[model samples]
Target: MRVTQHLWFEKDMQAALHCYISLIPGSSLDWQTAVMADNPSGPAGSVQMAGFTLGDQRYMAIEAGPLDSFNHSFSIIVECDSQAEIDRLWTALGEGGSYEQCGWLRDRWGLSWQITPKRLGELMSHPDPAVAKRVTEAMLKMAKLDIAALEKAAKL
Candidate 1:
């Protein structure tokens, strides 16, 4: 048995999947198809469905009439290897969207994402509690995560 993250979009499943796959390496659109039967969600061809892999994470998405939009409770967190990676994803996802503290942002499609650096996790999990606390404090102050600042906060 396997589990996959699922998403629901009003009418932008294809566009959102393409945009998301473009930002992440090793991601791909596994398959997509429209509903051919007269389903409750919509008539034939009105609902679109897709299955994809975003860096080994399987996701299933459907573009049907809106039931519930994406909220911060469910977010995609990209643990970036470098500041450049974080910045690139931040820009791509933050455009025409809203920014939140501690590396959280809502993309144009109303999907929340966390563009965070891998270093942040290392710092957050530091053996020394003070170091981890400092890193967390610094991270809480920023909209976009900065690897340098976080490292400095770790004092390592």
Candidate 2:
């Protein structure tokens, strides 16, 4: 059995796919095709099917509708190299969208993303669990995650 992310877009599947691929490193769009079928609402061929990669994960995007709702329970987390990288990603993903604290943003397409720095994990995984918890608490209070601050918290 294989698992892949299936994303539903209200109208901009291609735009969302491209935007994600652009922000993510080493990512690419693999295929796009229209599937023809006979059904209600619109038609089977009404859907635009796309295959893309985000980091190492595979995802499929469909622009078929009967517009639906999206919520916070699902999100894509990107691990970055530095604060600069996090900022870059946050700005790109947050354009035309609102920002929330702790390195989270909702993209224009209403997709939630966590633009996290790679070192944050190492800092939070320090030898002392209390330090790690401190780092976690520090992270929870910030909008954009700062690697330096996280490291400082771990050392405390």
Candidate 3:
């Protein structure tokens, strides 16, 4: 079975889709369609829906009006293999957006994202509880994750 994430946007669906597609590698916009009938968001011919893929994950976004909006309750996590990758995504995604502690950030579109390093899991799951705790504490103190600092906290 295939699962696709559906996102609701009040407007600027195309711009948001383009931004996501541009940030992710091996991503593309599949299609977009306008509403054929009058809808709550707008008149006929307004953007109704758009399909896009980020990496291998499929997502559909609808311009369903202000009836719904994004909140911190849900977020997409991007796992990075290296510090460079994490930095790139963090800098790009945090543009015109606010940064929160523990590598969390809100994009310009108000979508929440976590730019995390793969090593974070490894450090946080160390066999020694002390090491794991240290790493966790270190992570909690930072807005953007620092891989080197995390590794140091893990004493690795």
Candidate 4:
């Protein structure tokens, strides 16, 4: 079965979806506009939901009002092939946004993302569980996951 992530935003579902589609690769906007129940005063069609993709994962954006807020507890993790890839995503995602320590950044839309190197998993899931635990511990303290730091911890 195919799964889709649903994002709830105040009233910028269309704008946010477009922004995401522009920043991410292989992303496109889909679906027609619908009026949200919360905004009865707005124009006839301001767009309530839009389908888009950040990577391979498809996501749906909806105007769910301003009740809920975004936090670091839940974040989208992007695995990159090289340091250049990490830099590209980090720079693009951090545009008009806040930068946290390590590789975590809050995008302009207030979405938190972890731009990490793909090798991170390899290092963390190494042959030795004890070493992996150490690497995991090191990763927990940083905002961005550092491959070198994780490897150092794993080797230790």
The candidate that achieves the highest TM-score relative to the unseen native structure: 1
Give the worst 10-residue stretch by lDDT in candidate 1. Answer: 7-16
Report the lDDT tens digits of candidate 3 across residue range 1-156. Answer: 989999999878888889889988999999988878886677888757988999888999898678757988888899888899899999989999899999999988889999999999999998999999999999999999999999998985
By TM-score, how accurate is candidate 1?
0.97
lDDT of 1 by residue, 32-84 (tens): 99999988898998999999999879999999987998898999999999888
User: Per-residue lDDT for 101 in model 4?
Assistant: 74
Model 2 bad stretches (over 4 Å): none
Residue 155, candidate 1: how far off, in angstroms? Answer: 1.1
lDDT of 1: 0.92
Task: Give per-residue lDDT, candidate 4, residue 137.
Answer: 84
Best by lDDT: 1
TM-score of 4: 0.76
Q: Which order, best to worst by lDDT?
A: 1, 3, 2, 4
Between prediction 1 and prediction 2, which has the larger lDDT? 1
Stronger candidate by TM-score (1 vs 4): 1
Model 3 RMSD, rounded to 1 decimal? 1.3
TM-scores, one per candidate: 0.97, 0.91, 0.94, 0.76
Which sequence of candidate numbers ranks them by TM-score, best first? Answer: 1, 3, 2, 4
At residue 141, candidate 3 shows an lDDT of 98
